[model samples]
Target chain A: MTARRPYAGLIVAEVISDAADDALVLAAGMTGRILADLGADVVRRRGRDRGFERSTELFLSRGKTMSNESTGELLGRADVALVDGAVLRERGRAGLPSVSAVLSLFGGALAESDRPASAFTAAASAGLLAMVGDPQREPLRLGGHQEAFALGLSAYGGVAAALASARPHGVPVTIRASLLETLVWLNWKAVPLEGYDALPSRTGAAAEWQVLRCADGYAVLVYQEPDWPRLKAALAEPALDEPRFATRGNRLDHLAELAAVIERRFLTLTRREIHALARQHRLPLGPVWSPAEAFGEPHNQARGLFEPLGVDPGVQAPRLPLVWLDQAPARQAKIAVGAA
Target chain B: MKLLEGCRVLDLGIITAGAATAALLADFGAEVIKVESPTYRDPFRAWSAQDEPDAMPPLFRATNRNKRAISIDLKRPEGQAIFLRLVRRADVVVENFRRGVMEGLGLGFARLREANPDIVLASISSQGETGPDAGHVSYGSTLEALSGLAWVTGYQGGKPEVSGRDVNYPDQIVALFAAGAIATALRSVRKGEGGSHLDLSQRDLAAFMIGDRFAAASQGEIVTRQGNAQHHYPLQDCFLATDGIWIALSVPASALPLLSDGLAVGDSDRPDGLRKAVAAATAARSAGEAVSFFVALGVPAAIVNDGNGMMADWGEAWDHALQRDEQGLIVKGFPLQVDEAPLAIERPAPQVGAQTCAVLAEIAGYSSSEIADFAAAGIIETAR
Candidate 1:
């Protein structure tokens, strides 16, 4: 059976549109498409003579149709506005009153402020950079516009919630999911350490958990004490039987040594074998798949997780992330990954 | 002025994923019944190992605000019977139990569907319900690792560093998606479309978040960590300002003249030179001064704030995002604002089962004596 398009018929056959600035297109426009996939009549209104990066533009427009309607005209027709702060700055909020909900995916309060609000700036301002890289080295940005998707997803909820609660007495929803705020939310588990004597020390390639190299590829493991014996059995490594690797604390004390033993054992097994063993032992382990291999993943394919972007038969371009089984997004050409 | 003022949700969440989902709905004015157990409450309640008894943890407080609480012993037949009645009245049910746990409790989707045909059942699990590894145990971090995020994070040439301290980034991600799904499902039900099960896999969501990585990986390309460097020019990376502060930016070649080394870096076209030149140019200025100077020239630039930088008040956004409880604790703000609807807790998260009698009397039509009987029989507990 076809997945249900839960958004259909709620908004008069659907009404959705986005008109974000060039820099903000990926997040705002992508959010529009996600909403559109849910049966909203989504559209992207380009600026009067402005141009955009083709892939970014196409990524946003792949499933949804496009219109050159001015920002004002689009907002007049849209039930939900997936707006960019850049549009608010350029066009002003005069046109904003018509839409039922507004999800601003850029600098919210920071839109007009001196502080920067791009994904980079937001990440920095939120102190996410403090926890991302090595303690001794400079902060590194995560690959791709990592902050954009999170911000976009939040914007979707902001807009969805607005639509859900609209009434004569209800307030129109207006959410400004600051890139800074989302990043702050991302690091919520790390309690604020502003005045603490100690800050989170970065551990470059080292983390409390890791994706270790296996004989053929990589493995994802979440170490637990009860599973140590099972892990030892899976690897059949005599070294793992020692008392030093017996308990979680002991393993921590001899982490390097334990890791050395595990790494050597992993060298003898392929990723597939490791996963099989993980399942057998109920170990919290999985293979570390590359994007290339993700499409062919047995589980994902069986679940229909990856859809061909329909870009080409030979050239596979996987669709965008943020899958909803109810309303899977439209197929698009594989995005030029890592493209700024 | 609440947008979701009439929507009623049954929050059967235990961890961050389930709780945050319900919280998002509550933030938007949904009447969320945060259902916990008297014996086995949401682990998030005593989140901090050191938290005082009966005193809620900050994380729990932040995510659980703006919702009513009802502690029912689902393991008991009477409690499950009461919950089934709630199922008939609720618009949605959000849960993150291990697979089949609900079925074991006789509260599975099929069973709930029989009770309320239009009920939206959002089931969040580690690896989705249909996958080969569906039964595998995982935390938010484990899902992060399996999704290729952990492999790609960290410094260039460095091993993958797990994202977040103890926070499972995927849990929150799943929450956002789950909320959206529930909203859509509710809309569908309004249009006469039946409610359906929403099976969201934390692992799938993680892979989707880093979707571009998969695009690159599709061609046998593995883009390792490149600290602060975008796929474009190296000049687009982060740099240190004169006063020991870090700044992040990216300027196209057309605007190269805006930088002090515009001529040299533009002409040389070298990553190392660009990095050096940008650092050299801003070496004497403080981070704020440097960023302002760039903004003045219409360049996108910002200071790379560390933990210390995140401390400043959030300005106007804070007015709508945060609320304070009677204990004077400032809870995290709802990420969204519905025009005049600034979401705040009607009552700080009801003490576990604080609303047991009110809920039972109101929804299940339970008499006061029945509530007392249940409490006496260990079927439920009410807050003192």
Candidate 2:
């Protein structure tokens, strides 16, 4: 039997500022998108000149209705409100719903700071950029708006908790999530560990788990200390049996040579072949795939991971990551746009 | 009131993906009891504490704080019985074991529900519970590679890059999403919905993070890595400043005129030209001057900070992402804050079986004699 959607029969007001920081807009939109996907009647308050790319707009606006309602009108009917900091400031807490999630650039002590920040700057401030890419080169931001979307995920979690705990007509709950805090949370390991002298930093090739070139493309060589013997057996390469590569510490000392030895073997095998071998040996090897390749992956197709956005047959977005084993997938609401 | 003040969670999760999820719930005020087995310790406990053999590893301490812990030999029948007794009182059970480990231990979702009808069993895994790769072994970077996130994360025209072991991106983010999903499920149960088996896959969540790339790819957009350039910005890249610091800067289309005037770059339409001009201009100025110059012109800019610099800016840029415990050690903090009831670190990480006797006696209704018998038989462990 199909179970009811977790958030069915609820209304969410999404008021995002068009001229706000790009990350804030993206984060607010993503929070609304999650609510819409989870069966909420998410009404996205339309903003003039919010020139989002077609793909971003299509992905973030899925299952959400476009409306030109005033913030007062939307909050009057909404059970929850997802807004950017700008919108939250403009519409004070007096008129908000029982639950609201506010997205901003720098939260906490600097919540009111007007510092010019985007996702990249937030990532930089959070120390996320320093954790990726080659340490010798300039720090690189993670692909896409991870900092902002992480804030969105954090906001959604806070909102869900608020909903779970809310008493009907009780004191309004406001969740403040920011790109800087979210990124810092995600990159928590970068923080200095007490009594540890070595601070965490980027280690490109020296990384225990690294992406090395394979025959067809690239595969990330990942394994714990216990998997060393199994990795040696899986690779079937005599060079890996050297004493210098025995322990994790030893391997770290000879990382470049170790990576070269593994890459040499990987270059002889395709990603598919390497993946099969990884499965056979119970190794955690990962073969990097392009988005196009991943779209048609057999496992993804079997799991029904992606679905068309309905408005455009060619465009697709992933279903909500959560899967209720006994229930049918949540039905997508038809797109509705009121007068702008 | 705390968000989950009255909730109880039995956390069988280990390592990042599982343990962090439970930790987030504990931060939200759930009474999270971390369940571990005597025969097996969380791998994170063994990470980087070689100097102090008895001390909890920093990684484990970061994620396991605010939760009580107990050790049980679930392989024993008596231990399973004791666990079921705790299950009867738990509102949720979270685990990230290999696909069949729970069923092998006779504590699968069905058994959990049989013990407590409204139990929310969150099975967080590298893959879904019942897929072809469901039983596949994986780490965080492996999921990033397989889920198409690595495909998007790289230098332009370079091979795909993983966040590596240090910042296993997939593992950290999955905890956030899973916590939210668990909270949502709890809400459903509160609405009189029966127990739910939440099949959350880290790989699937990794894919969802880059859903826009997939959307564009599906429409034949040829979504390849473009380095630091985002479509929303006319020019964006990390440039070296005169002081040997790298400044990450983004110039919106609206700021192009100011950027052109500041950098003496004529053609804002040419992203390549603007990028070069910005790089040269930043190279001529100190990082502070470059960042301030850009900020004054309504451009987003910052010095790409290393770990120490990031920590130094804790108060100004952020406040609570990392906090000091009673011992004055830095630990993981909240990603979000609630205005009414802010989350906090109420306690430090527990030793194995630290709360076994108290939880067994108070929550499981086990008498001292029964607890002693179980302890004597090696069915459970109690901290000395």
Best by TM-score: 2
Q: Residue pairs in steric clash, candidate 2? A: none
lDDT of 2 by residue, A219-259 (tens): 99999888988999999999998999877788879998999
lDDT of 2 at A51: 57
Question: Could you tell me the lDDT of residue A315 within candidate 2?
Answer: 82
**How would you encode candidate 1's per-residue C-alpha lDDT over B76-151 as one tens digit per residue?**
9899999999988998999998888898998887788878877888888888878677787777767766676776
**Residue B314 lDDT in model 2?**
90
lDDT of model 1 at residue B279?
75
Lowest-scoring 10 consecutive residues by lDDT in candidate 2 chain A?
A331-340
Best by lDDT: 2
Error of 1 at A294 (Å): 1.1
How far residue B270's Cα lies from its native spot in candidate 2, in Å, is: 2.8
Which residue runs does candidate 2 get wrong by more than 4 Å? A1-4, A166-168, A327-340
Candidate 2: count the clashes. Answer: 0
